[model samples]
Target: MSITFEKLSYTYQTGTPFEHHALQDISLTIADHSYTAIIGHTGSGKSTLLQHLNGLLKPTSGKLVVNGQMIDTKTKNKQLGDLRHEVGFVFQFPEAQLFEETVLKDISFGPKNLGKSETEALEIARQKAKLVNLPDDVLEKSPFELSGGQMRRVAIAGILAMQPNILVLDEPTAGLDPKGRIEMMEMFKQLYEKEKLTIILVTHNMNDVANYADNVIVLEQGRLLRQGVPTEIFSNPEWLNKHHLGLPQTTAFALKLQERGINLQELPLTEKKLAQKLAALLQREVK
Candidate 1:
């Protein structure tokens, strides 16, 4: 299902003295089955915007259409249940939210709550555990006994068991080591590719945004700043710097080369593309 924001805005503590506008007049569309990244510094409304994907936050003024439903201030909480079912949200450090006695029970909770029978929920949990790369041996163990990475996988599997069409990740790789981060990211990539699930990633990692996202959205102080593909967004290093944003490592390296008058035809976003570009430059010099 596609998502569209129509001049959407959100406010915290709407009427009181502390009322703050967390999002303001944002408008954008996230295509179905696409991997999109939302990036910005803290207080830029990235998290506020993400919550709207699953109806956790309703638009304060205008409307947003997601999963064929229009959400606004008037949208009732009861009506959001089905929307939440279609969009699984993985908050930052989701493993901290696990509470069931065993890994299997933890993963099976969502399905069971959705009315699946015990047998059906268990079957779904088993399948999702494997999907998230959790071992069968871990299923019977207490979730608290597993390593942090394993616990994270179990948490993700719980969301997968619900079978959401759109997976919303808010800094999902936070707190993971470098290797663990890569594995977790690759899992999301495969889910986006093989499962054809729409992935909405909210991250501060420019490299991941450049490497994984088909499109990027930039928010600034609760307002829409820019929206484009990674190339277009990263091409303007000066602009990014002006806004206190950093480029992908590859893109930053390419920018440095350009400063030294060794510019490529275009900046590369990933390491492999950087290698290819450099090799092509070498080949020309050899000729």
Candidate 2:
């Protein structure tokens, strides 16, 4: 499913003394079935933008097109529930929201609530459990009994069980170790490949964007700063630095080498690309 925002501006507590404008004149079209990463510093309207994806928040003055539904000032909040079913949102720290007695029940909650039979829901849940790398043995255990990483998998399984065409993630790998973070991002990448899931991710992790995103949306203080492929975006280091945004760790290292007068062909986005470029440059020196 695609998302098109046209001059979309969201204001909180309009007309009140504490009123704040979280988004301003945001216009962008996120193509269907693409891995899009939204990156920005805190309070830059990143989370606010994510809320609008599945209609958790309505536009205060402008228009937003989600999937195909148009949301404007006159749009009713009730109409959003059905749209949410097609675009499943996995909130930041979604594991905290799990309160089901068993992991299977937790994963099946959405399908069951959507009118699926107990048998159907359980079958879907079991399939999703395997999708998230949760073994069958843990299906009967309480979600709280699982490790933090396993709990995260269960939480993601719940969203997958809903069979959404579009998946919206909010800082999904926030509190994981290096390995856990890589594994979780890889799992999402797999969904994008195998299920053709349209993934919209809101994250501060630049490396994840470099490694996994097909398109990158940069937000700054409630405004659209830039949007493009990660390579094109990272190529402009001066602009990113001016905005106080960061680069992937390897990309930054490559930049440091540039400062030391190392002449690699271009800035590489990932470690593998960086290594290949460095290896070619070294071979030239040997020659």
Best by lDDT: 1
Model 2 steric clash pairs? none
Worst 10-residue lDDT window for candidate 2 reads 53-62
Error of 2 at 82 (Å): 2.4
Per-residue C-alpha lDDT of model 2 across residues 195-236, encoded as one tens digit per residue: 999999999889999999999999999999999999999998
Best by TM-score: 1
Number of clashing pairs per prediction, in order: 0, 0
lDDT of 1 by residue, 1-287 (tens): 68999999999998899999999999999999989999999999999999888787888899899879889889999998888889998998999999999999999999999999999999999999999999889999999999999999999999999999999999999999999999999999999998999999999999999889998999999999999999999988889999999999999998889889986979999999999999998999999
Cα TM-score of candidate 1: 0.98
- Full-model lDDT for every candidate: 0.93, 0.92
